[model samples]
Target: MNTLTVYKLGRVEYEDGLTLMQRFAEARKQELIGDSLLLLEHSPVLTLGRGAKRENVLASDELLASEGVDLYQTNRGGDVTYHGPGQVVGYPIFLLPKERQDVRRYVRDVERCVIDSLAEYGLHAGIIPKWPGVWLGQEGAPDTRKIAAIGIHISRWLTTHGFALNVNTHLPHFNLIVPCGIREAGVTSMKRELGHLVSVPDVEDTLARHFCSVFESERRESGVSVRTVSITVLRGHGPEARVLMVRRIPERGGFWQTITGRVEPGESPEQTAARELKEETGLDVPVRALDYRHAFALGEILPPMLVEETAFVAWCPEGHEVRLSAEHDAHEWVSPNTALERLEYRGLREGVKRAVALRGELTGG
Candidate 1:
């Protein structure tokens, strides 16, 4: 069975995540990375797919801007949709196996992932005929409301821009647009349907598990053999948190990574994490071990090698200066989602998400 790597990107900007999807889709087309799923949330924003109508966006540019929502027209297959915090967005960067190249079947599989996930929450979700995505209530029923949306762009049998399921999303945000161009239908969320708050991480885990089941792939957890530490540095707590990421110098291939390094002889993973954080960014913050770990097979090796990682999260004040070491040329304090989108590796992206959740638990934020 093929192994599916899932990256939990807590929250990200629409454009940054889109660019990453394009890159991943291209890499999948080239057979570089295996089938991977990106789980994330977007800052308040509305996206217009290829079939989008401007009339669907009910709010004016000024109004949206004032509300701090960014708008973009995308190349996906559906109409206008709103994406924001509390909505779980899944982008599957997959190269369909030869026998499963049918786009409709592929979409149904994606819907199945969401449907099965909702089932775990005691919610029955199904497809509405003539419309893509998973919905609540019976098919063609007037009271049926959309609980999820799927918009995808496929190239050469590879896919990107998958689906969004409303977990704790603010329903009023959908009022700004005619969701998927369905005028009579309403939008509902897990929080509303369940009469309680549903943690995004809980939904994320359920979705990833079901996605793996539906795709006939093995779910490989990150961190298996290699001894290494991945630190997701944040500047604040809870919703106000911003992740700190550094760009490697030209000599190091110039890819972005969270604070990461191999453990030295006799050095504990926690010590290595603290040392790496200070060495990489000149930050001496306390490093706390997160519950997150990841393992991925190294690519392009004659003999396959698995790299294991233990993830950590560190808190620093907002305005703390990040002094880059020789290994890094630049640093940016980005949103947790942006950090996840910017990081090039799946392990680091998932590490950041784990760190964010840990922070929330510690701060009760």
Candidate 2:
């Protein structure tokens, strides 16, 4: 029987958790690790997703600091949200199987998981097709309140950034931010609905069960086998610091990553990779001319349907001016020294190091 890689934790450090999750998804896709789950909690903090409006967060920096809460702009969907001691943040980095990889469907499925889990506690939940989360009670019920939030980004059909369910939330902390930017609609919690705090293990178990059911049905229907890509580091160059990396969008959040895309039907992997680079970043360099191929997986913390990814490298440096497509938001010409420090994926970093090392060897630098 196929199984998921499950990780459990209490409080993950705020600064690194989001990046780690992004890397995990990328590594899984690049390396092909099977379904994986990263179960963890966040410190008292506020996070703003891609569409989040900064003005929605009403508190001043001094005020937030006084309350021991930190604000962060994230790559996920939705508006401002608060994470505290009791919320169980489940990042399910799963490949979207061939049969069930639709982004909209994946979002609905996550809402279903949360709704099903809530049902176990005698709470009825529903989804507002116009809104992207699970809500308490049935549609049109006065009790409706968002119970969970979903947002994601996919590279090569692999996913990253996932759902956050308010298990035993600290409601007061939420007051500072406009949850999902919806001032009229309130955010609900398991504690609020159940009148008691729910255990993280219990919630985790429920989520696992729902996910297994969702994927099992998918696997039976479509035969895409999933795998988690393991992370490997290759040493090269000076300062032990110089590295090259490729990261999925939004997790590198505000930074620009080299163009990346999935293989299309009848498309060669190299062709797809080269095309995506041009489409996403607008650097029209030929794939044959640049660097070397470094392959890895963006693991299963994603849509739970996508499978397989192989990445290769080709550099377009300072001499070039890029014409980026709308798929990407920005671009930059970063040096290998800076690239090593700034780029996100472990495998991509290693690939950069290898490229730099080879360039020096060929030039006798």
Candidate 3:
């Protein structure tokens, strides 16, 4: 019973996160590092997997770029696919004995995470034995939707470039390319399937729990952790109001340093942030007056999703009661000072400061 190290990074575009996970997995295999998982969301990118055909990408490179899309090649086992805003992608890097290697089993476990997550929002998902990933509705249901899609790469028994769950995703983004090389297979998000908005944190929480449960049961169970931190500004009675020092969420608790989720079509980042905050922490806060303007990296660590991100600053109600959506088990409100001490990321802390500063400077601090 050793503590499994779970490292959660946030708001990384598709390719950067994917590339880091792959490299991390390789490093873990090279040196016997304990089990670890990297969870985050990606920007828009059209990724072609090992089995993908170039024809699956209908848009030319120049055209895709003009429309803010990226293309990439991945080692994962699948064909052409799209990863953009509103999707959560996970990569778990671990080591396994030769006999413990099971590709199909590992993939099914990833799909299970999506299924369990979808069920939390009252959407039941199943698998089409003929295909991988989780399917929407029952086997014979008409107008079935895809709740989640999983494509991964496993090397020397380690895994990377995991599942992508369409939560509050923009479905039109998929029209630019043929998803998973299936010309007719349509893509759907949780919000789309449910006919309303769902919380990203809620989906992420369910997915994380499912990932831990399935992955642990099949292999050397490692550690699972979760945490909460707030980024705030520190001001004294003077003109020099300083941005609060950011802390790192302990490695013992899963760390989600960057909290950027996708804006479902028609939704602004402020609206999405407010909704996501409410879903993760039960509260109603108006995003209308909140500051909106921040920089985010726009590129899939894969093929296409090299788009620019428009950021926003969300302000919660002063004393609102928090109803923990099934997504977060615990919550805390800390100043940037405490956040920097408690959160496990250094670079992301700086990003938060820059984001906060940008919001203030642009909107009149």
Candidate 4:
């Protein structure tokens, strides 16, 4: 059996996640990594697949902007669909090695993973013959609803763009389009059917386990601490100082992380670090890019992205109040030790430790 590394990236911007997905597929193609699962939630956005009809999207650009949603055109096979908070979006980067190259069987296995997992949650999810995703209730019935959406891309025997299962998703967002170009059937979430909020992490964990069962891979854990292809800004100053940490919302994996964001075009890693500091936490502290730089695969095998990161420390000359962005649910100012204990990944904790070690010289303390 093959070993599968499951990467649980909490909440990533749609474009950022998409870029990494493409890279992961390439890695699999080149035999740089083994099979892996990329599980995450995208901020509100509408993705039009290669087969998507423009008419399926009903929302105007003005409305989407006002709602803080993004629009994208993608290469996957499907009609228009919404991916947002409270949804479990999974991308399985699998290579169809020789004997098991049947596309139909592969897709069915993907659906089966979801079906088996949802069953554990007390929802009997299955496929509706003509429909491509997992659905609840009998076919040709008013109560039948799509609980998961699957649209994928396979090229050079590699797979990408897996499935999106609605856990506690905002169903109204589906109203912005004729989901999968079907108008007769409606979409539903676990929350609506179970009459309570479903645990996102629990659902994610279940699905990962099922993937192992269905995909013939051994299970291994991976998550955010394996930060890759980005800049991390550790914000805080010393004298009596504390570093800042932010807790992500439950939908985005509910964990603590430092200020981090992608290095956008025309932006240096140092500039990106400083920008993320201001954008994410409303902080304007001075940023010093560390001499340390390293590259690692995003997770054990995810995006198998060989990320080159530039680390920075934002030293505050004095105390400043924190105003957080929507991505994080909570913020804290704590000692380096406390922050290290609270952080979820070794990658992040190490960054905090580095920041602490260099404080005196960086700030002229």
Model 3 misplaced regions, further than 4 Å: 97-99, 138-142, 217-365
Residues 65-86, candidate 4: write the lDDT tens digits.
7775778999999888899999
Using lDDT, give the best candidate's number.
Answer: 1
lDDT of 2: 0.64
Which is the better candidate, 3 or 4, if ranked by lDDT? Answer: 4
Q: Would you give me the overall lDDT of model 4?
A: 0.80
Number of clashing pairs per prediction, in order: 5, 45, 35, 0
- The best-first sequence of candidates by TM-score reads 4, 1, 3, 2
lDDT by residue for model 3 (197-232), tens: 877666666666766676553223222121222223
Residue 133 CA displacement from its true place in model 2, Å:
1.2
**What's the lDDT for all of these models?**
0.83, 0.64, 0.59, 0.80
Q: What is the lDDT of residue 291 in candidate 1?
A: 63
- lDDT of model number 3: 0.59
Better candidate by lDDT, 1 or 2: 1
**Backbone clashes (count) for model 1:** 5
